[model samples]
Target: MTTSSSYPDIDAQADLMVYLVLSQLLMRHLTGRWLTVQHVVESTHLWLLTNGGSVDWLQRISLGSRAQELAEEVAQIEGITFDVRTLEAAFSGYQHLNHRSPAVAAIYGACVAFVVERRTAGSRTGSEK
Candidate 1:
């Protein structure tokens, strides 16, 4: 017997799955995807703070609206700190370039990178408690 059906590319599937997850997460936690990129980024910030910051997976890139205090507490517990200034720069670029199709990808990528950087840094070192 010969194979007929083929499966999708693993990397493409992964990207789609990640996008779906992020889209739903952002929509559910914040407003909807119709909202401006700046609003989306703001929602992410609020969600992170509520979820107990980068030290918690819940706030890593999923359970966004968990609690600012919890985020800070976890970061403190992990002996890590959130870099506001670096993020502020990223956000500025994200917001400024809003309304452009090409920039949309750039904005989301930068924002995701920022969030990942914070979350990964803490957990990567086996410092999370």
Candidate 2:
């Protein structure tokens, strides 16, 4: 996955990349973790009450298996360096933010920010710059 020439199939690759990232986040939220379905819903309601964010629902989406497949695809594609742990942390912050949990967002935001800035900054400057 050299970051040299542009991938001709970027559109398809990007779609897969997005799914891979999103799925990892979902898995972290679900899968017998700290956040249960009830907790997730409660968090959503709390977030809505606190902030005017249009976060209506928080249902468990079935994408764990599929996300695993997408992750493999993303790995096969060149020039893509998104890590599942990074996505998981970003998603944690996003969910917490939706619930008006600034503290949680701050904690997770640091991890997400690091990965995002690292990837985008490379694009802004030359890869080796």
Off by over 4 Å in 2: 1-33, 55-108, 111-129
Rate residue 99 of model 1 by lDDT: 25
Query: What is the C-alpha local distance difference test score of each model?
Result: 0.35, 0.37
| Residue lDDT tens for model 2, 1-129 | 664443123222232224333444455435623344454345444444544433212111222223344434434444433344444444434433221333223323332343345446656786421
- TM agreement with the true structure for every prediction: 0.24, 0.25
Query: Per-residue lDDT of 29-127 in model 1, one digit per residue for the tens?
Result: 344333344543465555444433423333333323322322333223232222333223323343232223332343344444444554457557864
Poorly placed runs, candidate 1 (over 4 Å): 1-100, 127-129
> How close is each model in CA RMSD to the real structure?
13.8, 13.7
